[model samples]
Target chain A: MIQRLLLLLFLIVFAVSETADAAVKTIVLDGSTTVGPVAKSFAIYFTKKYGVRVTVSESGSGNGAKSLINSSCTIATMSRAMKEAEIAAARKKGVNPVAHVIAFDGLAMVIHPANPVRSLSISQIRSIYQGTIRNWKEVGGANARIVVIQRESNSGTQESFKELVTGKRMRITGNSETQSSNGAVKNRVSTTLSSIGFLSLGFVDSSVKVIAVNGVVPNEKTVKNGAYKVTRPLYLYTNGQPSGLVKQFIDLPNTPEGKGMITELGLVSR
Target chain B: MNIGTRKILDRSFTAVGIGSIVVMALALMIVVVPIVYNGIGAVFFTGTVEHRKMLHAEFKRGDSQNLDSEVASTDRYRAKVYDMLTGFEAELETMAPEKKTEYTAKYAQVQSALRALLGPLPGDPEPMLTRFKYGQTRWEKAEEKLHDLLYESKWDNSNSSVMSKEFFVSRAISFEGTSLARLFPYVKENLENMLHPEFTFYWGFITDSSVDSHFFGGIWPEIQGTFFLAIGAMLFAFPLGVVAAVYFTEYAKPGFLNSMLRSANSTLAGVPSIVFGMFGLAFFINTMKVSESKSVIAGALTLAIMILPTIIRAAEEAILAVPKTYREASLSLGSSKWNTIATVILPAALPGILTGGVISLGRAAGETAPIIFTAAVSVGSAIGLADVFSSPTPALSWNIYNLASEHEAAAQLRHVQYGMVLALVTIVLLLNLSAIVLRARISKKLKC
Candidate 1:
């Protein structure tokens, strides 16, 4: 009986190895946690239709670009444009990295639902993240401690937020919680009454009230027209020029199905 | 197999042990190596000086071809034909529409003639010729440099550098209309955009903190948060676990209490860290009202509970290993059981207890699941040792998770993260190694 069981196990293992040896394609995406929902939705939607499994991981836009440089992933889901250094690295690896705009994202400044603050200027937001503004009353809210929340270093949303809100030079409050994803931050703020955080427009919901940046609420209309200051393009970076399955994946943003997926996932289609 | 062959075979088998060790080592390496390899470019960060010099070199060499006043630069040649671009770009911000078939004939004529005449310039030559073909501003900026020589009455063929009349026939300097000479200072300064320090490396995001300006200048608060959380966890878990282990092993009833103790320990270990976090959020953070869920106390308390089983097991073994002779002698000398425990047994078991504590510390240093569930705040105030109870602190592990998430910070911190990790591992190793050495010393001193 043991011999027969062993024989069966060997047969199964041999069969599995044979199939594994067959050319299987994997696409890895790492980037903005804010852009994660749309990327994940797209990956699942595309894979089911095309039968090509695509793995999606959100480290931040910079990490996405970094992944492209290291050849760890085929596609990098970025919330920002590539730097000259990243481009040079890709060229070194004989893959001229190209950016494909998958979608447009509007970064939304969020406060706990209890916050009565309606609007803030970029300078005011900068003050909050910079730890200079510690009281909610300073920003037209209750006399409460202003709990500042931030994304982890791998989040593209935070990258764009740094450029727009803080001029990339300010420091966040030291007592910041660094959540790994947009959902994590959003969820924390929703549960914690005194907290404030930011998320991609897709991750915005009723639990957290969206505040206006410079009196502009992030929306499809505002972001599309570039009226929203916290808006940035979502991108996919590949080593060299993308071709074959990779090309098809990159160009998905241009297709009707891809657009549908983006819309369904609550992100603005490029 | 002969004796000589057998000996070689034995040596070969032993060498394969390292291969297994390599596999194990590689397994550990993957968690760090892939990310390190991905972020290696960030380590080669050239200070602002190198970046500035390279840009300066490129800009100077860009115009090296036509030092002569008569040689029409592309920007000057394009400025002569600026009307075509200005009209075409009126429809869209991007020149995508201009790249269509309608502008091709004129585009072809203008491009071919310019490509042949100017040959090439510095920096991204292909984009202007292809992707950004209708981006007349880039050409206009280049052309504005040539605007001086473009439609001049002298029309001396020259390089794009401002005409000092040395490189041209217009030695008299007799231009009446607002000469492009007035704009030379502004244009020369504007050209520096090709090489200006990009603030992206510092700015974490649109809503960046002030630290972005200082190039990740300091993380004293986050460092403080990490230190106190681990210390607090050790403070809370170590004694509780050791006492529980001692009581269970030394004094508990065999039939019911032993079974119950075993079941309790296994169950405690089996419980997911998230459930503990939920419990902490509800009990300590919310009900007890010590601080917010993101406070360091919440994390420390939760992690203490999480690592209790590990501490208990290690302590139990250590306590059991204590020689019975010491306890017997203490009892025979009219000492109470509690007295013996406090004096003899506890002192002898101190090294084992320390080992258990350090092992728990190492686990706490790397644990994400419990912290993620507990007091981890996305952003918190600057916490310090004094603020350990009230403030939210980001630990080393969480910092890595955070660093890998923010693109701007990640771009700049790849090396810092590795260095930070190296530091964290070194500290943990030191703590564990010290415990090990102390264990050895105590064992020798006690002659156990």
Candidate 2:
């Protein structure tokens, strides 16, 4: 009888504590490897200002949508807008995903900083990714083979590149090496003399030459004004109309302070 | 020194030894407990009805009749939750536009939380992704989802001196007097009926292919790849290592050439693993154009080089450890020097040589760096024996690093990562265990 009473007491305490755990505020932001850097910075600043514990995960845009639809995350930070299928899926689950544009990013074609080739036409770039243009000399560079570095299949940046540059129905060569993230792609391109890869404009550094496409170099001005072809808007998706902390977080990129932070990270803010 | 002083010193020394052993054991426990606990979760946990549904739909492994009955029972309770949602939606439509918008936002939160806890509602359209087709497969996640339904979490930033604290407001209080208010309590009360979680032992985790980058599935490809790479390395290194060891022990005179060769072996052993990857890439792939790109053959070759020196050293020691009387006896019985060395000396050293080979195989299997450039790929289906010369495959070592670090949903798949680690540890330990048993049996036979 005493053991039973003690067990009941222990269970009561456990139940009470478990319910109390719900009181802690946490904002979960997931999705988009390309938008990861900006989301991380925003989370840090937001947590500092609002005292909200913000968790950010960089799984890719599709996963971000999945998280939002699944109600796992409060905000899904995506480098690309939700596809029709994703929006339908969210609506089906009663999650009215509302897109908030945060920043603009350009897919910059990068090569070894020492490579002499200045620019490539859209068709030439397509051919290179398509495996038709295998050597650097074909694109007016050295005699080395162009080691194509690409992001893995889960990357939103890779999806965007395929849509804008590679086009559907054309496959990237099997020999093209696959890396997991923008940083990895940049690392490969920087280290390999004959390698060519694409990264978000913000990830471009002096170690790699951010080559021009169709006579236009990717930058804040070029990407923002639509002069650069391979540009996309970064987004943060919230289910229905965001309120409280979620609203404040979604509106961060519009604030003067947030714009400065975004620009510092090499992203173009409207 | 006095007798008591000497005794005190001796006691302290014994205490020190015991303390050190305790510390080592404690360290080992600290490292192993979490791994074993989480690793067990990969195969054994409170699996919900959705987990069963996923198994039935994806792998076709569960009983249809039992699953249907369970679904029917859960659905009987779930109907009321859906009724409350539609009623709330209707109430919102009749309200003022501003109020309607406000309620719509709040209503969506409750709906999503319900969807997460249970599967998609009756009126909801079919979901494309398998992840959405089911609710929380694990009971812990289900409870977390239920909390989201009960409370609306908000951050309290009133204090400026410290980090903000989060506070949860009861959803029932937020929607007081509304049709949705009654839904929260009713659903919470009947959550067990909604999701029948049971302890499941899913042995398929070792055999099944992963679903959605290891959100669910097994580590079969990684296990097979480790086996292939390790065996392939042994195929190349064992005979060559043993021959080199034999030559060094019996034929080579102790002179300048021998010392230089020994120094070179040590130098090769000292090279960092990542440098071996780079060298493999440069020499094997780029220079020799081995199979055009990364392959099992290339990886095995790189691993053989990495482990060759160790094998050679071990074999040399084993050959030297053989008693001189055995070789002398064989020679006195009119046996040629070469025949005596092969039949008697090698037989005596066989177990020792095998122990080295087994250890080398484990090293080759666990190694990630040398294979990264030469053979390992982050993601690929398991290849057959014929494809080893041309195809790069997912290995346990590389996949563990890839899944733990680079996977988009790495944190969500902690169970898979731990399972992979446990699988690898088991494989390596088993190899070492077999080596021990083999050596023991050989020693027993020799004595007889």
Candidate 3:
């Protein structure tokens, strides 16, 4: 019985390895939850148009960098550019990470649609996140305690928000609740009257009211025209200059169909 | 300190025991009732004509002739809505510049709301995403979208002392003088005619792969992945765990080393599951190069390690529970030690060992943390058995988290998340129920 079990195990390993070798013309993407939707849509369209299989994994930007360094994925979709340390790590592994800007996403500060406070300066928003401005009244709103919502540490959107609104070195208050994704953050902000959270421009809907940042609203025209101050370029990193199916995938945003998908999802095409 | 006082205390203690059991039962009910209730909505709900259309187009299920007739009937009502929109647009083009500008923005809002309720407008390009290719599939969601179309929801914060309240302003009221005013009431009255909703039982929620980030389709990939991961872990851990248990119960002598090993087994059980996840990544994927990255083999190995201690403890207890008379009778009958253990003790202990195995199997299936770093992906189609070593697949436990908290349209896909939770719960319950039945059958056979 033991011998038969061992034989079965050996057969499985052999079969898996054989199939793995045959798995060409397939693109594997790993990265940001922010970029996951776009990647998934593109994968579906790409498979339909070209008959090449595409699979996406939303493990977060940090893991995306790691996956690229490890040569596990063909493309690493990210909402933030790779950090200096990540580039150095990739270099050490002989993987030259190249970034391709796919689309532009504006980080919109959203609150409950009922909130009296419609706008906040960058510093005021930073102060609220830092816990110095605890009550909404301090920021020209009602006397309720501010419910600050943040994305998880691994999220690229969180990193981008930190860089744009709060300084990278500044610590977010312990009172802030950390949600895992943009949808979760939107859900919280939409439900809680005193809550404030940030989401990608594409996720903004009437469920939550988008507040002005630096006196400019985040919308397609504003973000595209550079009037939106908190805009960031979404990226897809490859090990080197991409080739073949990877090249075509990285070039998707340049195509009309891909551009339409980006606009439909609420991101602006560069 | 009298007999009567002691008897009163004993009765109170028994009452407390019963009270605690009742509390536990109530707590279980509170947690399970909502899950089962909402989870049922995933499979059984009022489906609109759009839903049938989506199924016919995507899954290639349903009667095409019936669907075509339904579409044609719905289109007759929907055409009036489109005509009203065009009439309002033409009225705007002939108005004064400032009035046209004012009406244009409001008209744009009305148009988008209509697009959301129905599919894309006539002049709009074909939507690239599958979600936009069809209108609301579920009647409940379609009603919510209709509310969004008929009225603009605004928060009432005039009195600032309390929380803000949401109130709606009718779009028809705002567009009183315009042709669009008639559109809202017309659509509201004829909604039942426009989208013929019928009670639908979508067993396909269990068998079809999701489309466009679970905006549509089923969760077969997650279910298949969970089964693969759980069964794969059992295949690796069962033999090793049972052998370890037999050695601990029958062969290991009571010594300092044996005591330390026993302590280690209990310690392993107490460690946090997340620690196993981190270790799985560090040891299996990074150091051992298990299938190049996160794969089922690596995840199975990690889960096997996590459940090993429990299996060992349970199997050891089962081996020990075999009546001493059985072993003695075998020995007296001139059987060797190994022979007695193999033929008599193990056979007697099989049912109990399987009970523990079944419980561990449920745990392995339900665990999310260990697989997150090793095997689970947020989105992937059902993988074949041969791909287990190289590709990561979506498991129910992990995808449940992804769908509920991370998917782009999480609010809209609450039913999908609930359905996934129900599927996982049902699978684990069924596994346990089968174990109970198997145990009863084995014990009955032994009695005979």
How far out, in Å, is residue A82 in model 2? 26
Most lDDT-accurate candidate: 3
lDDT of 1 by residue, B1-448 (tens): 8999999999999999978999999898987675455333223332232222222232232233423321233245434334333444342234456544444443343333333223322232332111122221122223432343322222221432221121232211322122222333333343333222232232111112113211223333344445566767887998899889888878887897689878899799888877887787667754676652246787899899989998898888888988899899999999998899989998898778778877788777666666653444323323324444544544566666655543222433455466446546655776577667767877788785
Worst 10 residues of 1 chain A by lDDT: A15-24
Please, what are the lDDT tens digits per residue for candidate 2 over residues B168-203? Answer: 999999999899899989988999888898999999
Error of 1 at B209 (Å): 10
Pairs of residues at least 3 apart in sequence or in different chains that clash in candidate 3? none
Q: Specify the poorest-scoring 10-residue window by lDDT in model 3 chain A.
A: A16-25
Docking class of 2: incorrect
Give the DockQ of candidate 1: 0.02
Model 2 share of native interface contacts: 0.01
Per-residue lDDT of model 1, residues A51-127, tens digit only: 66454545467766765665545777788788787788777866577778889888888876555576899888888
Candidate 1 deviant stretches above 4 angstroms: A1-270, B1-16, B26-45, B49-210, B213-215, B406-413
lDDT of each candidate versus the true structure: 0.60, 0.80, 0.88
